[model samples]
Target chain A: MSSISLEVKDLAINLSGNQVIKDMNFKIKKNTLTTFLGPSGSGKTTVLRAIAGLNQKIAGKILLDDTEIQNLAANQRNIGMIFQSYALFPNLSVFENVAYGLRVRKEPKATIKEKVDAILKTVNLQDKEQSYPENLSGGQKQRVAIARAMVLEPKILLLDEPLSALDAKIRIELRNQIREYQQRLGITMLFVTHDQAEAMAISDEIIVMDNGKVQQQGSPLEIYTHPQNIFIAKFIGNHNILDAAQLRSLGVELAENDKSNFIIRPELFQISITGDSSDYMAVSGKVKNISILGDRFEYRFITENGLELKVEFLNQQQAFMIETAITFYVKKDNIERVGI
Target chain B: MEKHIDRIIAKIVITLISIYLAAPIVATIMYSFAKSWVNTILPDGWTFEWYLQLITNSDFLSALARSIILGFVTTIIAMCCFLPVVFYANVYDESIKAKLRFITVLPFTIPGIVLVTGLVRVYANLPVPQMLVLLLAISLLSLPVTYQALDNAFIAHDFRAMFEQALILGDSPIKAFVKVVIPNIRVGMFIAMLLTFTNAFGEYVLTNIILGGNYETLKIYMYRLMQSNGQASSVLTTVYFFFLAIISIIMIAIMKWQGSKKAEEVEDTKKL
Candidate 1:
């Protein structure tokens, strides 16, 4: 069998006179966890649905393992989908729910039992065989949903914000568990989430989407450290954006009328003595506010040009005093040039 | 203190209304068992003689059987017919679904008498049997009600859940309906069945006009018997009341079970 890879080319979807997804394109390698990250209404879920053949009337081709699946119905596409709600069959026992796909294909009862048992074990839900879905915990329900979809041995597994409905602690725990299971099975996985942190934490490749288009797509660290646009910069993590003109006035290097936005991460700003710049891009500012956050103190400051900046300092021993004049240094390499 | 007094007065008024609503059924039962039902504020004697009389009457028995059988059959047919239409409408598109919903409930908007008159006109031309015509009339009368119940049930369900379950499992729409949709909305289904059955059983005007004194359903039998003063009529009324009460109790029990099951499911999910 050919390796299961997914490619979407110039996909466009219009629903009720509104173009929700426009010319969106991406590719997922076989046996890798790829995530589509975007704010709500940014068409992340729509893209996933389109690939799964849940959304018709799309103007593009979706290829799975090099076969065009755009015309296939949702069931015929052989793509597994775990809904944001977990979508476990509320009426069925855990085993039956997991074995649902196999049962539908009219597999032998013994084979269904064996496959369900193995999949349940994979999801660490072996003990929940006779338990109904409503009796499963949020994380357990998510696991059952994953098991249910994966048992079909689908070409690709699509998870639409699976951890969003979960509590915080469970979200973290289940995220790791899902990643582990996806890796172990070598299944091509496409995860959708509005949460950038969750996306960065689990995905092998992350596609940042905004306004029905791909903002950026790269490895987690690459996208986080080198955002291609202001939207991706602000969306992936907290970043203080400054105009290129403002950075040039502060004696930072600039090409003639580059006119691009400069993004500096909050964590990259370090407080140092004005005279001890040490080959770093330094700017003088007055600390306007300081707040304690466990092991670090986050300081908000105003520069001479009336621009606001935030810096996170690792609190060593003393509390940071408010209204203190501090010189903060941002490494030149850390300042990423974003969209014009 | 003045506001509290107003609240108390409102409570008293509501309680009085509830009691007033229950008074008719209590009076009906009392009159059905009363040995001397006339010229008295209350029964002078209570006995099961009327009930016994109703059981032995062949016409009354046949009417009762016909009513029950027609009620159940209509309910089943309504469920089978309405579920697919509702499910398909809900799954496909919203605007079209809304139009379909309006059409399904069209029978309810038209007054029952007006609708039944139209049905009579249509039935008059057909060469169908009296029993089938009666069944069809009763079924049409209860159609809107059953449709509404099942439609509401379908609306309340997680469509994504149902669709995803079916899609992932590779199950056909029919299997999904049987296994997932039906079990999830068992309460709504039960209520629809009971309401449809009760409505069919008690319907008089359509049965009367359609049967035209030829076929006597339970309601027609009761109406004819009530016209002629006899203890046998009172007994039949008592039997009918008892049967209605039993059905009502069963429906209530089913609803309660459904509610409890849902609560238990919620609690179990929380525990997990």
Candidate 2:
């Protein structure tokens, strides 16, 4: 068996007359969760739908287990999808909705019941077996949708913003539950979402996309700490992008042959009241604004040259009044150089 | 104070509208039961003899049966033709819906007289059965109601997602539609079928113009009675009005049941 459960090569899709997904290529490993993270019109869902054989691909190949299956109808593809809307059949009870696939395949009555009951238990929804979808809460309905898709035992499961419709607390709980179930069942999952934090929370690998293209794909830590371009730097976290002139004004000199933008994370700057550090590049600034972010303090520092930069520090119950003069330092090795 | 006045005004308006709408039916009912009502504020006597006579008439029973058969056949044909088309338009190709908007205005643009004239010109001499042509024409005429009701059914759910999910679960398109899509929209479909059946049941112009007296439907029987006997005609009209009232009651009851079921679901969700 191939290590890759699903692969898309040079996939392109057009809706009406405009191209929605362009030359998209990605591979999902077996029993691992990968996320397609991007903004709304970034073609993330388009690529995911193409992989499930739901959307027609104008040009490309979709391989499942190293065998081409792009031409197969969506039903024949043996893939499952959970939509953001939960898409539960309002007429069917929870058990019926979960058993829909098994019933379609003509599974025996006893087996369908056994499988549905087991899967419903896995999602902690055994008590909701007789409840219709409309009577359930959003979180409960989503759980039913998950159970319905998972009961089919698909080769790969595609989740399109499954938690986007959920509340904050429920979203966190459901995402953790989904990741747990994916691991327990050993099913390959392709999750699509515009929320970066959700993708970072549960994905084994995150493919960041924008404007119908894959901007970057990597482990969450790698993508977060070492963004390859300015877009990724700006999108992934609160990173300050400074040009050569801005860096010079901040008392940090670029390399002799280098004039690219530097991506500096907020927490990378070490702040102090006294200018005692000469080994690292340093600048003096005042705390223009301070936002108490529960666990950390985000300080907007303005340097002598009037260059504004964001600096963050772990909250230690210390007091720093507004307009307090402070010095911040960063080593040359800590900055990431990104192209224009 | 303002709210009380508003309530009073609303009640008066509703009462006036009710009287205006119900006056004709009330007069017809009174006429059906009157023994000698001419030039009198009230009937000199009331009797059930007209109703008994109409009920005993063999032609009246056959006319009622024919109208029912027409209703059932037209409803079946309308569902067969428009259900799949409306589902396709709503789920897959929304552009088809834009093309189908013309069906809604077809009756206004081409009156039944004009359509029957065209149908007679084309199929009057053809080997095709006139009854079949009439049935087909009636079904076509009822398409607007069928299409609109069926289309409304799809608005409440993400039917595409539900259908695609079912397909991914191993159902062919037809099987998925029958198993998953149909149940979700059954209420709406039922309401549509009822409306179509009601429309076809009460049809007069196309039936009279196309099939004529050969297919003596209830409406045709009523029209004939109107010229010959006033008491008998009033009785037939009253019977027709009751039939319509029963159908209207059924439709309203179904709508109310559906609404309550939805309200219960909402209440359940809120409790959750």
Candidate 3:
């Protein structure tokens, strides 16, 4: 059997008169949670919708297990989708909502009940079988939506910002539950979210998108540490990006032909007063601003050469005041070269 | 003191408007039971003789029955034509709704008399049944009310998501619509039907001019009696008014019930 569960090749979509997605390509390994992370209007949701057959693509080949499904209707594709809105049928009880697909497929009443009951149990919503959607909390409604899609045991599932409408605590709780279910069921899942933190927390692989194009596709840590371009570097994490001129101003000597931008994460900068500059590229700067970021203190530091950079340090009992002189160093191995 | 004076003036204005609107209906109700109402501020005597006569008359009963049939048929036809169009506009192609704006203004742009005149000119020499033509015409005229009420149903919920979810759950488009969409929008459909039925039942010019006396609807019978028997006509008019009042009451009751249900749903969510 093929290890890849789903793939898209040379996809292009034009909505109305504008090209929304252009030549998009990617593949999902079986049973892995891959997230399309981007800012809003980056076409992540549009790409997810196109894969689910809810959107029309002007040119594309969407394959499931290496078989083309781009021409299939949405229902025939057997692709489960959980929308941002839970989209539970208001008139149907929880059990009925989950059993709707089974009932539509003409399954026996006993089998439908068994499947719905089992799926509801999996989602920890067994007690909510008789409850209507209106009576459930947002978290509970989303559980029912997931159960409704999972009852059919689809080969793959698409979740389009399903937790975006939820509260912070519920979003954290539900995303963990989603990851657990994906692993337990071994279902290939494509998650679309504009939240970088949520995507990093839940995804096995992250495909960062910007302006309807894929910027980087890799493991969450890989994408974070080795962003393919300046956009990804800035978008994925709060990396301090320095162009060649800025690098030169920071007293960093570059090769004659080396003209690449350098990216160093805010958290990777080590602050010290006694570190020898020989072992690391060190810059002396004064703290310009301090921000309390819960567990970390983010200090905006301005070097003597007028290069502004952000450096994050773990919160400690002692605090540094604004305008306090500080020296921060980045190891040579930690700085990454990226494209514009 | 100025605020107090403003409140008093507002109350007076509301009271005067109420009286202005209710005076005619109040007088008609009194006149329906009056022994003789003219040349006096109040009736000299009260009786149910007009009511009894109207109830006993076969023509009045048949006319009522015909008007009811007309209302029902026109409602069905109008729903059949407009429900799918409205659902498509709301769910899939919202651009179609922009083109449908002209239907809301149809009655104003083409009055019933003018519409009937055109219909007679076109279909008079044809072999089609005039009653069917009248039913279609009444349905077309009631489209504005039906369309607006149906459109209001699409609000308050993410129907597109609900529908697409159903489709992904192994339902064909039609099955998804019938299974998911219709149940959610049934209340709105009922409201649209009620409005359309009321418009058709109370339709005067189209029915009278198109079918003449062949189809003597309630309004036509009232018009006939209006020319000869003043007391009986008043009684018929009062009955018609009560019929409309009952429909209005039902509509209001449904709206109140729906509002309470929504409040209960919100309360339920809060409790969780």
Candidate 4:
């Protein structure tokens, strides 16, 4: 199958009188799942609506497979979107909902039947082909919704918080199915989610946003290990954000004007018994709290200089549980500096 | 003991309210079938002679026919025009909704006498038929109920999302509305139509004031019979009561049909 790429350039959206989405640009690579990761009201869903041409007052060029489609009507764009509500026509049975687009396009009856049947099977909703949306469980309704969209064979599928409404078990289970389907079909998908774990699990690349603008866009690991700003660091993990002055007092290498903060992961801090103190900056602290997290142990500690710290250790050692006066070591190489 | 008393008091209040509301209609129904009901609290005699006398009158038949025709046509006009208008106002032009709310309440605030007087003074010189004017007037009076029904139709479900989803699935706005929106809001539209029909059917003041002798509706026909043929008029009233009862049954049937159709299952094989 041929590949399709979607690129948005300098997109700005103004709703009523206020600007909701500022100048935004992003490219969804071919056959890759890229998620717009942000909290609610961060303009992520606004971007999805704009791309679908539902928000007409957008100023930008949206190019799909090298053709500008900003002027196209929503129906004319041929982009399939899975709404958060699933939005399955309540009056329509599962079969009719899947056959709706095909019927609108005036496809042959037998072909519509075959395609709808196959798609329903693909989503594991064949048993529910006769049921209405209200009669089905939340997971079944979502699968029918997916089957309805997938049967259309659109160029790109836009999922706007598709799994956010489901329970934890169904969400993870269905999202993994969607990811597998994305891989099998090699379909270009731009999934919008507020969950960092969801983005990390499903996306080939994740675009993190706070306000309207993109905070950081990269692989989940690249984003997690090397957050460009304090927002991304604070958002992605439970890392301790220490300012330049605090780090300087701890005697890490830095210039005089290094006023920016630094991120230290919990797992990166080590006990001085295993590592040489000459190579790593060593500090002793009072253990404030300790909690076991299955495979890892988390400790809240306050140093002599009054800097609070959270450090996680592998469950292989219970010795740290009793050590309140133990020294912790942090390598200069492991300290990640924030650019902003 | 106190809680039991509270429950008993609540039940008594509810039963009293129900009887109070039902008493007038019960009295009216009893009066319509009576031979001489004024001498005592109980009706003097129950007879079908008034009904037989009512059906034999050509004027009564024509008035009944006229009222039904007008009510049906007015309901069709209201639904055909107002449903789309409400849908558009809700989905596209929200500003028009404020105007619709004002117009819906206009019929209720202005007395029917005042409205008829204004309309007569305005349309007195026009060459149009008085029947059409009355039909249009009755329909206008039913607008508030129709608009509210349509509003509820859109609001009670995920209508906006369904429309947008259909649009994304390659349906034009019109096609999406007719095929997707119309079917889903079918129950609401039916209710609005029924309300409009009942309003037009039972309307008296406006019909009498504006188009009384020229295009006599059932209400005007009954009013005339009250003086000339009181028993026949009572018979007409009984028939009208039955007509309304039949309509109510039909509305309930429509509601039941919608409910049953929604819960039905299609037997598709090739289960996964």
B-chain TM-score for every candidate: 0.82, 0.90, 0.93, 0.79
Each candidate's lDDT (Cα)? 0.82, 0.87, 0.90, 0.85
Docking tier of model 3: it is: high
Output the TM-score of candidate 3: 0.94
Best by TM-score: 3
lDDT of 2 by residue, A1-340 (tens): 6798988898888988898878888888999999999888999888877777787646899999888988998988889899988788888899999988898888999999999999999888999899888878877887788888888888888999988877799999989988988889898999998888998999999999998888888999999999888888888899989988788777776576667898889988875423445546787878899999999999888888898888888898694779999778886677778876
List TM-score per model, in order. 0.88, 0.92, 0.94, 0.88
User: Residue by residue across B1-272, what tens digits does model 1's lDDT show?
Assistant: 99999999999999999999878767777777788867878879998877777778788889988778778887877777766777777766545776776776776788768876787677778887767767766776787777777777766557656765586567666666787777877777877888889988888887787776776779888888988955666666767778888988997888688679779877766665
The numbered model that scores best in lDDT is 3
Summing lDDT over every window of 10 consecutive residues in candidate 3 chain A, give the lowest-scoring window: A271-280
Model 2 CAPRI rating: medium
- Cα interface RMSD of each candidate: 1.9, 1.1, 0.7, 4.4
**Candidate 3: residue pairs that collide:** none
Model 2 lDDT per residue over B166-243, tens place:
878888889889988899899889989999988998999999988788999999999999999998999999988888
Query: Tens digits of per-residue lDDT for model 1 on A1-340?
Result: 6554998899999988999888888888999999999999999988988887777789999999899989987778889988888777767799888877887788999999999999889888899899986776777888888888888899899998888876788889989988999999998999999988899999999999988999898999999989998888888987888897888877788898688898988988766534445568888878888889899888888887777887887888675578777677877877887884
Q: Which ten residues in a row have the lowest lDDT in candidate 1 chain A?
A: A270-279
Give me the overall lDDT of model 2: 0.87
TM-score of chain A of each: 0.94, 0.95, 0.97, 0.94
The number of residue pairs in model 2 that clash at the backbone is: 0
The DockQ leader among the candidates is 3
What is residue A79's positional error in candidate 2, in angstroms?
1.2
Per-residue accuracy of model 3 over A193-213 as CA lDDT, tens digit each: 988999999999999999988
- Flag the better candidate by DockQ, 1 or 3: 3
